[model samples]
Target: MLGYAAMNRTLREHDPPRRCNRDMRKKTWQRDGIERAAELTEQNFEDLYAILQWNLDHGIYLYRCSSTLVPWNSQFELRELPNYERIASLAESCGDLIEANGMRLTFHPSHWCKLASESTDTVERSVESVEHHGRWLDLLGLPRSPRYGINVHIGAHYGDKAATADRFCKVVDNLPPRARARLVVENDDKESLWSVSELVEEVADEVQIPVTFDYHHHSFSAREHSYREAFALARETWGDVRPVTHYSEPARLHGDFDARPQEHAEHVAAVPAWLRAESDVMIESHGKEESLLRIQT
Candidate 1:
């Protein structure tokens, strides 16, 4: 009986009551927003290239490059395709296509686990990796493209949330101003300490870094927090900067596995008019074709 009571007490402590205040209920809109979208699949570079071409033809302005298609990881040396110059030329060609269509490209590092071992402390390493990649982009002259940026998650729950936020700020501060300006931090799944509100508040207060309003992460991480509340917080934190936002279907088990493709238009409808007025939204759905169709419809 004592053991049972103790277990119940532990569970109660872990699952605290939700806090939803009236101030958090306001509707907000993003100003001069853009409908950015990504082509996500387990597909290879050729498929991604074809999808890019299609999006270009259709006048879609924003796209995300799959990390798998780029040489992002330094741990395992994968086989070189043709030549380093070819890879650079390919990226330049893609850049030209996007420029011709008046589009932008954004990249997300493959999950923290894939970037380095689970044992590796990702907070510091993630920032280092960003800086490293920023240098590569500078070398390739890709950052000079009309719009290009890297999106990353708030660090995993290592210790105190406040301490992690401080570390994150320090890392962001260390980068060159131009590179720092291009970095957009995103909220992660429920298991991470930096939920949507937490990330927005911390970045705004500490780093003065912009937030990426990821709809699925907001829904998954703060299940009790309404979408209106999430939008309000995002607007309050990062104002006027036309944030790069992501939208996807909520994962069932709180991990990377997306259960179904997000209905982009339906999700957009749910977005309060206020948020729509101020932010550039990106659809990160499972199947690109269907997701884009939904957005169009």
Candidate 2:
């Protein structure tokens, strides 16, 4: 029930380190174009195949999807392009591989995807971001549920925590059914805002979005709850789907001199002793697959 993020660094069979292309530079969809988009889409799947094959061979069945798999996806308007379906078709193939291998897929949007921002424009943009993620899940033929979801954080409170939670729920209410069903909110690592308990009391209790717990985050903002107690509270939010949690060691906690306290370590420092039941973990580490390997061992 443990898996790493994209890019398995231990396997040299895949030549390039990562699959998503960020080489667009200053290219706009108008001039620098869909040509590179098409190329990267194809390249992504080819590289993805290798990663999937590696996972299947090694018995790792949980994987987090890269948000950048489709280049400029959220930034560009891509639906009208003639070859967009080709990209969708290829993505479907990748999804088929994932399903065939019994892997569970999840996506965490970039930090800027703030669903509860004070500004209406930012909230709308966040909605669009979630919708885009839902479309990809649709292309993959995945169900609209926490099983395959777009996990996001509650945005800045702008000085009013209660008002922010209300705004968060309003945005959730506005989301189309497809996007709404795919949403899961997580407790952040910072103490200024969300904790597992607060997310439940404020957001999940309001609109039914499942909570994704991060043990590392809990350590930072736990509110004195024991690991088992906090984990049990989080597990209750998932309802039907098995819970998925984020696990990582802080780099500074393990003797790294110059690292920040919240920065993820290259490998798992330690797992909580209370973790004995069945639940999936999306391993957040600098070391990728190599980190998961070490932790599992």
Candidate 3:
């Protein structure tokens, strides 16, 4: 099944604009506190349910939910929300819809989540980030499996790949089951960063978690492997579950010649047939769900 990340354009065009990723600035959160978070979280969950239903109706069953589904989630526990019961109900309903339809739902936390950071404080915050994502899946009542994955990228090397991988695995081993059971790491987009083979040998082999192949990222961090070869290696780490792969064209190749190599385009023309058949391909273009719609037609 093919998918898109957050923000459904068609739904966002509705009367009230239906998107789930509501957020607040740190200053705003400090002033308004939990009350504001409660408000946004409630709206986010409501919109999230609507977004999932909209996706299923359009033949898109896979999605990466926004990390900001609960604004300021890292500051406190999910149960601490002022409208905890209502928020939880919304989330459970969303999960029921997903489970009933066999849809695939996942979360990719922000880029700051570096489980292998050199600083103890950085690593702590990173762990919190991943844990919250797991808690979200738990709230949705999704199974504790990679099929409902909480994917992330060990995007930084901090000048030492071996040590970084070691620290990352150590953290993964100790994560709360809600997070650890659903965690899957993705290959990075820089040659100096982690590659599919490197993640498979270092992280996946060490932690027993799956690897998510990123087709666009592979070219930059190919490590001498072809796309099919890298994807196959990542696929094996998934065990019985189908691996998730990110597919997109660089903005440079998609008409913006001056754009950075890592920049994704507004729309991806298509997904390779094998990727569409063997794995769930997330169309990581700027157009979000609209990109997938264009591809489908």
Best by lDDT: 3
Q: lDDT value for candidate 2? A: 0.78
Query: Which number leads on TM-score?
Result: 3
Question: Per-residue lDDT for 1-297 in model 3, tens only?
Answer: 889998888888999999999999999998999999999999999999999998999998999899999899888898898799999999999999999998999999888888888889988999999898988889999999999998889998888899999999999999999999999999998999999999999999999999999999999999999999999999999999988889999998977998989999999888999888899888999899888988885
Instruction: Residues 28-122, candidate 2: write the lDDT tens digits.
Output: 55676777766776667566666777787887888887776677665666575457777677777778888777688788888998988977788
lDDT of 3 at 79: 88
Q: 171 in model 3: Cα distance from truth in Å?
A: 0.8
TM-score of 1: 0.63
* Cα lDDT of model 1 by residue, 189-224, tens digit: 564546767877777667666666776667657746
lDDT score, candidate 1 = 0.50
**Higher-lDDT candidate of 2 and 3:** 3
* Count of clashes, each model: 11, 0, 0
- Kindly report which residue stretches of model 2 are placed more than 4 angstroms away from their true locations once superposed: 11-13, 16-18, 21-23, 28-30, 75-79
The order of the candidates by TM-score, greatest first, is 3, 2, 1
Residue 58 lDDT (model 2): 82
- For all candidates in order, the CA lDDT equals 0.50, 0.78, 0.92
Question: Any runs in candidate 3 off by more than 4 Å, and if so which?
Answer: none
